[model samples]
Target: MKATTVLAVVCVAACLSIHASALSPFGVGRSQLHKKRWWSSVDVNDLHKYHLDDDPQGYFGYLTQPMDHFDPLINKHFNQRYWVVDKYWKSKSHPVFLYEGEEAELELGEVAYGHHAEMAQAHGALILGLEHRFYGNSTTKEGLLLSELQYLSSQQQLADLAVFRVFAEKKLGMSGTNTWIVIGGSYAGALSAWFRLKYPHLVYGSVASSAPVRAQANFEGYNEVVAASFADPIVFGSEKCVASIRQGFSKIEQMKQAGQLAQIVKDFNTCQDMTDPNDFKTFASDLQGTFMSAAQYNYIEGNSSSIGTLCQQMMVPDPYQALVKMFNPGSTCSDVSFKDFLKLLTDVTFDPGAMSRQWFYQTCTQFGYYQTCDKNTTCMFLPEVDLDYYFAWCKGGYNIPSSDVLEQVNFTNAYYGADNPRGTRVIFVDGTIDPWHALSVLKDLPEGLKSVFMKGTSHCADMAPNDPDAPPALKAGRLEIEKIVSGWLMQAEMEKKHK
Candidate 1:
């Protein structure tokens, strides 16, 4: 084996060998983590305790460490563990940790710990993190599965939360009911709703900020939205309909049909000082995955300074060559035939109108479109690659069908029935200017849910008002969310108990 391959194996072995007893199948605790207490002001940072049963003194040393076979240049690794105080004076309430979303470990929760955990602590609650099952320091088999180990059909990762609750309750010394609150943004918001649905008894309620629960809806619609939202209006100059972007895309499609798409990509990429070149290149590039191309394009369009990097990734130096290697290690670029290449490009296209047609006729009966394509009345869709489901499980293709992109549009319409009485509460928060939120198809949320609109911003919404740099309204909003969440949890609990 090559050095990199051998090193990856070693790391995988080390991870697999790490001692983790199945004290609780899902990390549930046998006892509560903290004593009952009513305090005026709770210090989130000052709080530190976990209910791991083996450690008698209850001190859990924690740190972030690198995990197996990571390329030092591209990947980061770290682990976070918690140590808790003994069970003395502890209340009956057991604390449950809520893990943040998408390729993050549990520590990201600490990033938003200003008042979340503190408030729970004041209520005699033990707040533990719901770690991502195959991410960060948590691993299963060579990080290969890191891309697609597990997820809910709703794209909900609630099962991980349930398992974590069991872990904390039994192994971590947590007690009473698993009354944990689910919290997060964007993808995490979707998770919050999933948790409440999967284990109503365990999770009191969810504080989903920008939840996208309608799984596999308009995966492309979200990409288009985010791209449009971040693209420099100065470059486009005016908001003409989606047609403005479509006009730009039309040129590439024509070129693609003429067997000149590659040259078109080359010309735009090679231009010395191309105006709005990244957007043009994104439209032209034959990216194998969905969402990734748009995401890269959006980044470049938004951060003008990053244009050079975007150029390099798409064309100039062709950064995608390296990624292609990761996807099909040791395979030559030319090995991909023209037909295969075209199929890849076609699938990656993010045309909403086209996808809606396909879902209704081509795919399965998940999202309401149940008719089969045949004979005269066959569902007519533009001939394009179905990248959403194509490279979904491939290596390094996680973002191709990012949970947000999938759950927000076509998936929502198909799989996530809008009027289902699941009592699913969803909070779709987005900046008024955030293009991604605009294209969201997260429908069927419970009437009780609240979707917040953060004015004039992109994807960054967590650290509002108190950033020492945040707006006043943001500060107030941050603190007020607790009460909103508390009420939701109480209502959910009441429904379950009295049902």
Candidate 2:
């Protein structure tokens, strides 16, 4: 889920195990959090095989990475963490599958239990997952001061991957013989595709799952897709589900207009009074975000029944009460303070656990994926959660002017070519139910660019380990990805033989 405020920080924790997408500031209901890690279900034997028992870090290693890849004068370097699985690697000719890290820390589970591991076994491939700079323990400096964060951008990240590939090749004794394939989900997914586009010589192919390549400042389409997913029958959502959501928001708006702040607070169980208009907007945004998280991660493993339950709850006569029940299950008081959220976002003091400040900086200067509700007429969120709200957050947090934010967004699209990235052997995968798909490449493009658009699936659903209970489309999609990857390796071998 993507939003403007630190709400994404809260939602990231909720959905992190399921998908590697951008975080949203919107608070996730207690019930929405995944009970177990996504990799917890992986076969124990496979887990043992992938685990690097000899290393103290256990499948994890850190590389000395340049702080500024572009600036020769800046000699500062940091430890960039990575995980590796070479149990399936047969020879120097075997392919290497690299998982690009995103806004969060690099985890061993990423390479140990996903479809990448399954594919690595099938193809005798070496698997690696690299941590993105400034995220997790891959920090460049002591703090997240705006000046320090200047080093964090997609271009620099791609350069890091390029340099790391060379270093990894030397360390693994493969030099230049192995074919490298990059794989990632969500933000990391975008990096995968962009890596191929920017450094095709370094990577043979890319599996970009749920990657939103396009950059939009006022990304109202995010919530628009969320609203659509509420009515999408594939996820067991109905027209009435969407209507109830609208009704719920409408009731909140009516209450605010009638000056029933106390009644609203009592019903929603907010931690603080919503007397301030900004606080009221934050409360509404958090409510809308609960639905966003539900839709964003709908139908994945533990979450398969959540959307259905949400829809059922929304259909209750008093939708306002039902909405409250949906998010504040167990009747917990929600922390809906806009001022506190701002403090979190604006604070530059480095807290490895809280990545919202770093991510929001990226949004302000690079992607501009500010999800606003004002642009869409049928938006289920309050109008007060508009672009101006996000703009205020951006300005307050980073001192980045709204005009500069828009310019940077335009620059990002211009630099990356938005959705029409010129790349080969790239498969762009997206699930219909994922709101982030609005900005991904959903159709086939020239020069071997393809899309694996799955129906009734949510964010990065294809990357999940193949389950017996998984949908047929998802299983087929995985097979199709394998076939494409196999073909790439075979073609590379054929070219090598010819040479």
Candidate 3:
């Protein structure tokens, strides 16, 4: 794809922008108070005005970068805590939550800003974090009303980016002239690539870390990819570990079949530094975390044997800590057990009730070329089995999908990708040790795309750990990025230069 062609695609996409309806239940702003950061209340009345000052008692505003469009009567809304509500209300405004490496939000928008900031700071770029639509303060409403929260989708999220750019440029004082780079890991990384494909004019460059854009969204298909990677001798070091893994998985599968899935999971949590918990909350949380950790990585290899091998490594004594780090990083786990670790691998739920499961189903039936009715007024998923249920299960809770998300709202093109004359640059950073490295979208990335395969990380490379200059190898790669992106942006700005 030529640079000129890429620029044209971006421009054309931007020309087809959508604006949020001011009267929608989601457009009003309200505020609330909290100790850490003040949240605005959700306004149920007017949607055009964005109120910032009506915060609840005891909350402090945390946005370091000031916005001029902020209004006491109308711009910002508050909640008990914006982060939690911001996540729940996504699909309103693109919400951005900063976790500071402690409480990581799994939402794609939050990760994008966090990862982008880390990378921008490393490269000495002036990082102005932009929140996505239906998230954070960017929502059309004051708070997350269960009824209004159902419209979240990738396409809506992308449209929100254009709306946000207009808002940020006018309120946050950015000139769209400035180079905007989109960065993210895992699902968000996939979004970054999709964003460029969808709205090239808004982004100057894109960094997609540990890309997970798969052709099919089936559990069996995803696991096959992971199983194949594990089968590769180079990734596993030895055939013995492979055989042991096979035996372990057979036993684990038997446990699941025998109705001992929950027990094996309980024992695994008990091994996590052995602190006696007053309730089963910690155990359940740990089990879900372990399960997701394994499920996300299952796409790297092609079968059960490879997954079995990976599980065995988590139980061995010499590399136990390493395994723990791989499976459960940033959390305490000094006393966890082999059974505990095994539970994590076997914990994946392919039942329609699981979110990851629902995600694939909803996305596949709608956008994987299956073509159902218009997604705007009618839905492709049945009310009983859908992504909401799956998401609830992942959070270890049950959140009934209200009529809000059950409506036939369009989410089909939310994360779709298309080839363009302007060959889009797609960078995929994978941590070698991160199990997810096995099931990335790099293989499916459009033929002419540019990519960066970061060594030693699960997601995208934020920056090099010890030497902040992005490590030597990344520095070299980014140089090419700088040249390519700078040239592309300059071409867009200068009509006569490339002609």
Candidate 4:
């Protein structure tokens, strides 16, 4: 991908865990009045609005994650919190559907309203949602201590899922023939697809929605896609809007260089005028994150559209004012400020949910997935997220050798075969606009393994319920996904009958 006339492509043009790309960790502190963490809200109304609570649609339980999955006899295990919601069908032959939870807690959107739900009804299957370890209550503890967090790797959770499958099979009195299909979006999606590869016999098939199977330490293509999307004429975005965004970025860069701290503080409504280069960089990152989050979650449903809304606002005449418009829509004052708009973050306890910190730990130690920008890069909003951040996290957070991160990441890539996932029954689904898609399997694969890349779409659009106003590409993608999954079930059942 090149730096097109509109956007930068690594100068122009990538996550480690298939985790949902994040916003800047610059939100105000947690609400002191509310003990609930961000995303901890369980109300259905709160589900999509940045809420990250335990499964509101299901119940919770515990499963022990092995300290060492390879050594079964070495039983230094910790109980991990697990959640589930089950709806069984009449016939014993009905298949089971499992939604692999991601960095955020589990939600029922996949099961209650999407193609997965429709399939569950069509097959009269059992639907279950499992929260990923360390996200919800599924942890040795809060993971405050480095020792406790060490076991929270993807490999450890994969083993944990295998154990759950057997326990679930017996508990449901499922016959040898009744098969299970793992399903998830984002990190969970990556896990779902990989599970089948790692434990072929355990799951009949998988749907990895927006899964980033490949782990790259530097992923810059993310911003390039955002640039591409902004210039996409079909989505109502215009090159004018793209140019306005570019101008905004350039203006900010100029401001910082000129030591016009007072001007920037006035422009984005910073809490205070920042003179320090590091503080300026932090502010720039937060600004860039606004674009990252908006672009990645550009799915449109009815009047609700994330990227569309932001792009429209970018059309505001002045770049600085345009930024405030796009990033702080809630503000109405003639003299608006960014901090005033996000006053909640002012709370010291402010962690919308602890997932940001948690995911950061995983990335530094195992994934090396930093969404960086550089001379050859394009996410115009962010600076080159220095390798120092990863090094510091590793040394300070885990007391581990910083140099070992690359080696560990290499070993992990080899262990999982991200470029060449060895699997028989998995479908890799991705959105053309999703930055993570660069590291995911976007092309067709082996006989039983395949891929679906949807255009004019954003992250995980297929994972949600089929909105009446959804793009035709997603509806078509879901149809193909359903057909593929149906075939896998038939194959699994046929094998069962022969046995």
Best by lDDT: 2
Report how far off residue 323 is in candidate 1 (Å).
Answer: 21
TM-score of 3: 0.48
For model 3, residues 184-297, the per-residue Cα lDDT tens digits are 444445566677667877765566555444322111222232233344443342445434433443453455458775654443433333222211222322222222222222
Q: Is candidate 3 or candidate 4 better by lDDT?
A: 4
TM-score (all chains, Cα) for each model: 0.49, 0.90, 0.48, 0.81
**Candidates ranked, most accurate by lDDT first:** 2, 4, 1, 3
Which stretch of 10 consecutive residues in model 2 shows the poorest summed lDDT?
25-34
Local error of candidate 4 at residue 258 (angstroms): 2.5
The CA lDDT of each predicted structure is 0.35, 0.75, 0.33, 0.61
Model 3: weakest 10-residue lDDT segment is 1-10
**Tens-digit lDDT string for candidate 4 (1-499):** 0000111111011111111123311111111110111122235665454222234355566666666677778667666555455553645557888877666544444344455766776788877767667664565443545555666788878987888888777766776577789997666777888899999888889998777777766666666777887777656666887787888888877776787868767656655455644345445555665566556655465654555676777777787777765444554323222233223222223132445445555665666655666657655564524555335545654556766777777877898887678768889888876666777888888757899999877666676554456689988998899999888878777777697
Q: Candidates 1 and 4: which is better by TM-score?
A: 4
Q: List runs of model 1 lying over 4 Å from the truth.
A: 1-97, 104-125, 142-157, 172-178, 227-262, 268-421, 424-428, 433-447, 463-465, 471-480, 486-499
For residues 239-316, write the lDDT of model 1, one tens digit per residue. 332233334444445655677746643443422221332222222222222122222222212334122232233332
Better candidate number, 1 or 4, judged by lDDT? 4
Model 4 worst lDDT run, 10 consecutive residues: 1-10
